[model samples]
Target: MNHFKIFSTAAATTLLAPAAMAQGIDAKVNEAFATVTGPFVNFIFAPIPGTSFPWIVLWLVAAATIFSIYFGFVQFRFFGHAIRLVKGDYSDPNDAGEVSHFQALATALSGTVGLGNIAGVAVAVGIGGPGATFWMILAGLLGMASKFTECTLGVKFRNEYADGSVSGGPMYYISKGFTQLGLPGGKILAVLFAIFCILGSLGGGNMFQSNQAHAQIANIVGDYPGWITGIVFAAIVYAVIVGGIKSIANVTEKIVPFMGILYVGSALVILIVNYHLIGWAIGQVFAGAFTGLGVAGGMVGALIQGFRRAAFSNEAGVGSAAIAHSAVKTKEPITEGFVSLLEPLIDTVVICTMTALVIIISQQLIMEETSGHYLMNEAGTGIATVGGNTGVALTSAAFGSSISWFPYLLAVAVILFAFSTMISWSYYGLKAWTYLFGEGKTTELLFKIIFCVFVVIGAAASLGPVIDFSDAAIFAMAVVNIAALYPLMKLVKAELDSYSARLKSGEIRAFKH
Candidate 1:
């Protein structure tokens, strides 16, 4: 066993030597790319005056909110139905698809219920204050409408390849919707969305996940070196991802719920123990939301920040989750749409709220300020550096303050969340890659291999700016996706009407299979 471990390490090092060497070149290229593109992104995403929110987030939130109100807050009315769908009340395994409803939700949740829930929430609370959590949940509630719309289209426009494979997402919807509407540049826009989705899945979804997991493991389990973590993580990720959607589905279905419950349960325990401070924490959230310097920027800024974190976490308008939702074995697209509504609830409303509460309650205890509180640590290297740099650490600190071993548990949860996200995203990128570069077995294998390799690279390297660029790329895809969705609202409405009619007519009785 010792010899085998040594040999495995040696083999991994040899294989990764090229990646290490290539990192320097990749960095230089990335630096040059950033030099050209950085200003544009920053300008485009710049915060609105008098608020912490950015323009991009504001646009997304506005679009989503309009859709929600226009659609009659479908999320609120049909949430129970969505839960039934997720529980397999309407699942048909023999239907045309790669996975079951539960599996598909797990796969999609794997993508959304990830580091964003962990690190992203921390960043929001760190910068926007606990009050940001209130806005985040509000945005999440509206985001459910966006998720329903995009996912319904994802299923409605899905393509079943000759080999019985599935291909769907915003790319398909943009092109198909435009073609259906007889619009010019429909295919071109679809292709653009596909390209962006592919890039995002590669970077934010896969690489970022591996990188964060590597950091957490290294921090907890001695200096095992990032490459070590990367290799192991890559191996496991590749092993599951290479099996295609079924393997990804199987893993996520099991992991997503377990980790989610564990993390939430832990947070609840802490909240209960500090029951006396619940009111104070809630007060801080509201107080900060209305009167802090952060909110003084303007309602628009606050709206943007709240919307940005919500979109980032729930991914309602982003259209990435649509890829996963498309694979569900359902004849009724609206059923899946209803199921997709639960995503933002699980992600933003539930998980993210717990994280925000823990951080807010804990910060109140540690910090001296009662009004206009500010974290002194700007670097986020340790617990002391307060100026909002410590994303995951702040969450960990909050958990640790109550339960001594909670930090380690949270760390493990982060790894699982990140891992599940990477695998699911690998499939999303693969679909996009296959869409662009023919879906031959060889091409598919090539993409998977390259994806696995990047997992290691992301784990080993410092990609602070690269991750940001990738995140922007993901959000950019949403811009195109939501544009397509707005025009195709009738189609979703049609599907919803059809599903409701069927349900009313007893054509589709209580979901048995």
Candidate 2:
């Protein structure tokens, strides 16, 4: 308690400083970070010459594409089964009180369905034009295959504790699956995966969530000192995360569906009101997707933004969801895998597309005359200033234009989404931390404390390089994870084949209505 007060005081002093002063401090931080991490980020996001499509995004897109083909589009074939799993239709009654596929799906969704759906779609449409939505939806569909494979392997190779706890993810799958395949160096690949997951959890999952949450609140409540928000958020999240608590994260899952319903409900209202423009908006999505709508990079730029943001939003190929899904207490490992497919669909296809439509339907694009950057549009009712900003501001403005009070509602929703995301990602990072640092009370506590501190830092600091580094770190996880996937994909295919045969043979028992 004493430590909490002291930490809160320090956060105010450092993070609540004037915006200009904060920018100065953040500038230095970004410079130092850029000098060290710039090359790696550059490599990860390096755009193709004569086009804006980056190599890392291409890597993810290719993987999703390959998996969809290899699985013969299992996401399509088993879509009904996936819904049933999430609905507990196939759940064994004897496993009562244990984690269900819905719980696992909600846990994973809490992480993937946060700011990316809100802010990321705004950025994609802002820069890539409305056509990016088309590609974003496409990527979400294809990425479902990646989700199915990684999650199935996660459960198949998980280490089930005697106490009903579970630990798995790319780290376990890579190490265990590789050895099972008579391949060497599975440990090395797993270690690399663990390293990236830890970094990614810190950057993309924790910092990005807090940073954007602060941004959204400040936009609505006035740009008061960031530390004020930072301190409050850091404390609340710390309590949930520091003790390896799981229920708060589960509680967060309850927030997701409400948030989604409200936001999407509001967007649908706007679409219906502007029914005549829906066709025009969708047309823009297709046109901009293929032609880039006279934008800079043409079709490639649209595809790059769409794919990158969708990957970030749903995290299909990154192998993070596998960690959360591994906890479901199910007789069939593949059942959890099927449930996992719903994440990208709800997150990207349904929610993100709605956000993009709101932005596009608003038809608010303000390109800077001097800097060549598109500023904010409040459905033409307001003007956005030119400066560094995330997509959250633009998203808020669009909804606020229609609903008037939506920004306030959005601010509340953002905080909940961000909090839920941090709690879930904390588990992902902790697993990676334990894989490297060993499991125990002290070790877990140490990592949690460090994670909470970053929450403060993320809320207070300038996020330019931080976001860049965070995005790079998230994509870096894909690099190591996909490496493991190639050698072990055949094994996953065999599992799918075997599971399908048994279900078809009526050898698998499911819950009766």
TM-score of 1: 0.88
Candidate 1 stretches greater than 4 Å from native: 1-30, 48-52, 293-302, 367-389
- Model 2 C-alpha lDDT per residue in residues 1-513, reported as the tens digit of each score: 000000111222232223463467676876787778778877876777876676767777899899999989999999998887777777875551236777788778888777677767777776777777899999999999889889988888888776666788899999999888889999998898888888878776777667667777776667776667778888888777664435644665677778778778889998888788777767778777888776546677677778878876787888888988887777567777788888889889999999988877654332433444332233422223224443666787777666788878887877778788888888889889999988777888899888888888877776456556666766788888887887888988888898899989988756787
lDDT against the true structure, per candidate, is 0.74, 0.75
- Give candidate 2's TM-score: 0.88
Q: TM-scores across all candidates? A: 0.88, 0.88
In candidate 2, stretches whose alpha carbon ends up further than 4 angstroms from where it belongs are 1-25, 93-98, 242-245, 364-390
Per-residue lDDT, model 2, residue 255, is: 71
Root-mean-square deviation (CA) per prediction: 6.9, 6.2
Kindly list the per-residue Cα lDDT of model 1 for residues 91-155, writing each as its tens digit: 76667877777888888888888666766677666656556777888989998899899989998
